[model samples]
Target: MRYLTDRKRAEGLGASKAGTEHHWYMNVSGVGLTLLIPFFVFILGTSLGAPYEEVVATLSQPFPAVIVGLTIAAGMLHFRRGAQMMIEDYWGGMTRKVMLWTVICLSYLVIAAGLYAIVRIAI
Candidate 1:
């Protein structure tokens, strides 16, 4: 009396309940990056090829410094999530676990280094 139909089993769900949350995080970060990238490019571009003093002065300003800082933070987070998802889909077992950890570590490293550099210039 316990042979459930395919539809009945399918009604519940699969592995993770947090897929939607992850999806939204990815989408939101993507949108943030979309807006931030142009500003980041503008800030970086202006400083490019300029004298070291000028570039340092430009980044020292509050506005441009904040823009670069936010861009790096958001971009690294977005990269981490996307890479984790990709590695999960393509890898398995220990390999998948190691890859996810490695990517997360690298993302944090980039974020910290970027903020440190920006702060050094801005201050």
Candidate 2:
């Protein structure tokens, strides 16, 4: 028979296995968003309130297009993770699963739509 302390026995069973991973992901994405948002805002501000042709021309430039794409992708992924965490915390059972999947799909859809718009504009 093996004798184990209670703490040892419970070491890995008391929490979600991916909690640390989730937390790290959220922190990293938060930092990335912090850095990217400023540039994104600047790019957006420059394009905002302009005529259609001017907006398209500004976004068509490689730098602005790439920045917008990155911002969209990162922002959506970050939003997905954060929303999942919130849903998991406040929900349970099948409802939790449904909400999680719905949020995931919605985030992806938004990302795809945003990127597609950017591509069309850039091209």
Listed per candidate, the RMSD to the true structure in angstroms reads 6.0, 5.3
lDDT of 2 by residue, 21-77 (tens): 676688998899899899999999988999999999999999889889999999999
The number of clashing residue pairs in model 1 is: 0
- The number of the candidate with the highest lDDT is 1
What are the clash counts of all predictions, listed in order? 0, 0
Model 2, which residues run further than 4 Å from truth? Answer: 1-14
Worst 10 residues of 2 by lDDT: 6-15
